[model samples]
Target chain A: MNFDFTDDQQAIKRTAHDFLADRLKPDKRRELAEAGSYDDGFWNEIAELGWPGIFIEEDHGGQGLGAVELVILQEELGYALAPTPFFSNAAAGFLIQQAGSDEQKERWLPGIASGEARGTVGVVSNGEAVLVPDADSAAVIVLVDGESASAVEAGSAEVESRDTIDSTRRFSRVSANGGGEQLGGDVQAGLDRAEIALAAELVGISQWALETAVAYAKERKQFDRPIGAYQAVAHRCAQMMLETEGARSAVYYAGWTADNEPDTTPLAASMAKAYAADAGWRVTASSLQVHGGIGFTWEHDLHFFLKRARTDGHLLGSARSHRDRVAELAGLSRAAATA
Target chain B: MDLTLSPQEQAFRDELREWLEKNNPGQEPSGEQDMFKFRREWQKTLHDAGYAGLSWPKEYGGRGATLIEQAIFNEEMARQKAPGLANVLGLVMGGPVVIAHGTPEQKERFLTPILSAEEIWCQGFSEPESGSDLASLKTRAVKSNGGWNITGQKVWTTYAHEAKWCMLVARTDPDAPKHKGLTYFLMDMEQEGVQVRPLVQITGESEFNEIFMEDAYVPDENVVGEPGQGWNVAITTLMNERAGLAFGSAVAVKLALGDLMDLVRERGLEEDPIIRQRVGQLYIEAETLRLNAYRGLTSQMKHGIPGPEGSLPKWQWSDINQALTELAMDIRGPEAPTVDERWTYRFLRARANSIEGGTTEILKNIIAERVLGLPRMR
Candidate 1:
């Protein structure tokens, strides 16, 4: 079995990489983060590129691609640490496409797919959805609570803007008292695919952090030699590689499983999410450690990656929560608990 | 990227599956000699079916299977819980090394017996003083009338007592550099000066042995490669040991994890949050190990050599296996230290997983220095 990407997939990856490199340059990201707002014009350019609808069906006015293609774009965006509403928008699209009824699809899929009407997703807790990313800008917001999901119009929900440690993206707190229509299909399937997307983003963050750390280790000198000459520093970088690669493999496999083997998606996606959430935070923190004093400062771009990784680790679901899901899906069946 | 087998690969797998279903040799009996004999006969059955040395070249009496087929064979064997062949070292390392480096005479005399398990092989690379730093091994050999006379001590030599030949590396020149002076020799183990003493490990099992060679005879024809080239030859065998073996080990860990879940259910400990979390962590680690191995295989196929991550699967396997056993023991709780047979033996055996093939420290060093381009610690 070959794990290497196909020619088409490789072309998508290369195009995304070069495009993000030019569009999401470090200065642009820093400029947006400092302004505490993303460039709406630049986001329209991304939407025009059809990234938000990369996984949507052709019947729904979008590219009839799969989760693998969506993951490739998300990974590049994560690597650039771009200040955009891509993930939030994609999360809403996934839930609607996977769980929406015929009427629901007809009503919202076209707008969401064409990027004319952006959407966001948040987990509902006690009738309030916290950390609903880009909710202020999204037209439709899907709030999931347990097995059921509801789609609320932004005006109908109490969308209070909230700022987090990660300035790379905006978030909001939303409250809806049965304000929106309930989705009638399998919400868990949609959530699992969403988790795989998040895992892929984490893989990208970890890769970036690891490359930054390794490059730093080779140049930073201590006691008349590169710090990398010492096993302590070298081994730290090595461990980062292990974690990053593990996350990457898991994410890639999960993405493929979501597209090709829906039955295996829950377990594979949980494993990917759990492993990558931990890896993302750990590798970014380790890179910060390798950079020493400079990494801790706001002047360096490393802090942005570290903050985004930590925030992403807690987004959608924490690593511990997904790990518990892994426990259940991976043969420690819930039936055993009751028995 | 396709994770499923192609039509040809599926056909190959189905054929092998049918053969195994009909000719499966169940399990081995208890006694050491009986077990060895049972495995030897099993190897003969496999050899007759063209499964033994499945990856060896057709010129060397092999099926000339592709690397993916070899991986499938390994995975299927592990998945079926099939008995291991007696001449594992011969089929995996020794025979491959001979095919890669041996003379025509050596190939003619060695390949067939190894496949049929008529002549079992054991490696003699690790000495008492040369574990990780193998180049420092001081096993000396001097030229005699027609061959070399070798004197050395080799530890952790599995199957030393039963092996007919030892893939021995020895110093041929004392004055040369540590890495340059060595030679690779296929030493006959039946000579007068050779002795094998079983080393009982922590599990109270004699799975490995220490061999003392006081001028053991090695005729000139037994040398696999030329003199002053043992390091390179030994490295080839070591690389073979690491490559293509990960798929098998990953499957084995997965099987153990399944057993662990069964135990968790049986003991009604599945509801315990701590045990569930531990099991979940182990599951993630195990799946990641499997995925990483597939990625590594892809890189190897593309580059014609394993990439830096090739050092990874073994390290991940050791960690995941150890954690799985530890969690099983924790679930056992008060019964952890008791002689519960399977779990206890596994828990203790897993302690050597990290130390056996290569230490975790050495693996990290390899990754840091070779893979990441870090300066050497020294």
Candidate 2:
């Protein structure tokens, strides 16, 4: 019943933390965000580390580590706020691996795994999957409409750039028809894993924001005392810890379930996603409130976290939708029926 | 992180489960004394099977269970809706304190009866005035003929009427500082100087009591640790209270939530979008509490004490349980306020969840000043 990372997992986390710290400095990340593009050098370095395929099967030209390892990387990357295609590519990788046909796996899984041909998954609505991250650069785009999924080559889809409030990553509007083979297996299971990945990222963002807020509260004094001594600011920080830890607990559990307890993954994934989406945005916003005026300025780095949190909360699914799923899956439907 | 138990832990759990199944005492009688007697008998049954004092070391007449086993024990007990042991305060706090700091004779005198439920114990830490600022308590014990004469009032004393021993803390040095002058004494509750008056709560139950200790006698041997070190001993008791309660509290909340879900389904509200969202949110909150508790338990096992996150589960449990009841009422719709249901009573009971343990506001202050490194307000 240990709820701690293993020694090997800790090593992976430390490696990711150190690499991102060294490579994705604040100025570098800001520059990439401003350009609305990922640096090829940074992308190539991450690819060299075999991070994209950290969770893909070993026989599929990649590492066979599970979702726990994948989340470690995603969380570190989120903390760094690095402008890379790691998340979108990993989202695509999850769908292809979990839901793709054997033929589709042979065609795209190798490239996605090796980071040679990066991929992204878009949730299709109204014949277009808007806000599809890295669609312009993605080689394969898996457009998901409900339980059905189809992998569309970037060349065959009409991809238009979609600017968003969060510049740390790029998004695109993609529409494809009469192209790309439909995923033959369970699309919902694949999406559940994807949602778990997003949830992990949200947890990371909240953790970063919380640390930043705590650091600021300790140093930023008012009335000849650190404002944190006042219950107003202090309580806010405490509440942030509560929310962050709550999201973290759910995310970590869901990540473990994805790898070890597949039968429980669907419900666990939705719960994690629902809790984290709200926590990710709320904690950062509260952190901003603690910082007060300086946090409102573009010059401060807190806004970046705030924007990322807001964006992540609505990425694959809103908290409301996930909560509804949780309601159904966690036994509310039966209760209501009997009622 | 592996959330599943190992083979050894699973074996321990299965064995405990089998024993519970075989020796299950069923429900307690309705009367207060009858319930207490029933619970004492149940504790005796547990003691005979070596299920009591699961966290104490083997040398101290306990199973010497690992932290995981202790957690599993709490979870299973909550799952089974087992009756609480008659000497809960002793098992959780008093025995541990004695083992940690008492003389060898004190352990011999106190530990076994606590396990067997032969001598029930209750806490006498809070007073009407001291409450959250326990060190500021005015309960004073003066030097008498080779013993101390304790004279003061203690409020919120649970099980005072049924208790044979009261784990009482009082001011031993009138001239010493508020926190430095105290002493912890194992006072005999079955004495003329001791009085226990039931303090009826909003729930219309006398679960707690107000005690007036008029020159209660306590020999020097009964003092825990040293004189003038009661604050530290009390802190240990409080920490133990918070750390050990999280898992049991989480399981209890989950059990309540399961019942509420049944109510939701019974009301045919599961198909309602708004109701579904609220229900789902509660489920997420409850699951988060459960997971965070396990994480906190793991941290405590590694570090020998709970981290700041350990302070969380109680606060979260209070909120989640309260919300579950409120949602049950909401699901009941126009019939919500009707006393025809169990949730109305549960909803009122949950109001004390935050206030009883430690006020939610006080918990925030602890997290801020101690955990977050915030400067103290001078």
State TM-scores per candidate.
0.98, 0.98
**In candidate 2, which residue pairs get closer than 3 Å at backbone N, Cα or C atoms, i.e. clash?**
A335-B265, A336-B265, A338-B266, A339-B265, A339-B266, A339-B267, A339-B268
Candidate 1: which stretches are off by over 4 Å? Answer: none
Query: DockQ of candidates 1 onward, in order?
Result: 0.81, 0.81
The residue-by-residue lDDT of candidate 2 on B1-378, one tens digit each, is 999999999999999998888888887788899999999999999999999999999999999998889899999889888888899999999999999889999999999999999999999999989977888999999988888999999999889999999999999998998999999999999999998899998877888999998888999889998999999988888887787788888899889988988887676677888888888898899889989999988999899888778889989998888888988888888978888547888988899988887989889888888888888754
What lDDT tens digits, residue by residue, belong to model 2 across residues A124-233? 99888878989999999999998899999979999999889999988889989657789988898889888988888888889899999889988998778778888999
Best by DockQ: 1
Question: Scoring model 1 with DockQ, what do you get?
Answer: 0.81
Q: How high is the CA lDDT of each candidate model? A: 0.90, 0.89
A-chain TM-score of every model: 0.98, 0.97
- lDDT per residue for candidate 1 within A266-331, as digits (tens), equals 888889999999999999999999999999999999988888899988888898988888999888
